[model samples]
Target: MELTPRLAGMVALLAFLPVVAFGVFRTWWAGAITLVNVVIIAVSLYLLMSPTESEAHAAHGDDVESAGDEAL
Candidate 1:
């Protein structure tokens, strides 16, 4: 399965729900933790949005042939 930004966001948000619920039922600072978790999830999702340079290059078929040619 290919991991994508939307998938990562969905997964992280799902994982965070329990923590948010627990925090709500616990202390105030515990509730504050929900915000921190959200920020982390957002950043992770943002990063996942783009494939790295090598990954992008590999996705295109041309690079693989060029690489093989160079090895000869």
Candidate 2:
């Protein structure tokens, strides 16, 4: 199965839920930090998985077809 951005984020969030739960049992601040970490990780995964503008265009066969267009 391919790991898309949404899937990766879901996996990361699930993996971190336990840490947040256990952290909450210890202290509120610990739980808060873990929650923040989860958000950051999810966002990072999405950004990393998604293609950039040029990459997206290239993948869709939207790139200039002619070699001469490369210089522009």
Candidate 3:
């Protein structure tokens, strides 16, 4: 099975959430910062790993609908 960009982001977020929660429960402001950092990282990874419009179209060949879905 292929590991998509969305899944990569999800996995990163899952690991980061616990760290953020730990910091928050400890009453540290660092938790909020960690949350933001994690979000940024996840977004970066997703965008970087995801297929471009042209790439998606090329990969799918005649399947325009699938390419459009991937673009979303």
- The per-model lDDT (C-alpha) reads 0.74, 0.78, 0.80
User: Tens digits of per-residue lDDT for model 1 on 1-72?
Assistant: 988786777776776767777777888687677768787977778686867877876667466676885479
RMSD of each: 4.5, 2.5, 6.7
The residue pairs that clash in candidate 1, if any, are: none
Model 3: how far is 14 from its true place, Å? Answer: 1.0
Per-residue accuracy of model 3 over 6-64 as CA lDDT, tens digit each: 88988878967686677868757777677778889889999999989888667667766
Candidate 2 global CA lDDT score: 0.78
Q: Which candidate is the best by lDDT?
A: 3
lDDT of 2 by residue, 11-69 (tens): 87886768767686788888778778888988999899977887865666655674346
Task: Find the number of clashing residue pairs for candidate 2.
Answer: 0
TM-score of each: 0.53, 0.75, 0.64
- Distance from true location, Cα of 37 in model 3, Å: 0.4
Candidate achieving higher TM-score, 1 or 3? 3
Clashes of each: 0, 0, 0
Return the clash pairs for model 2, or none.
none
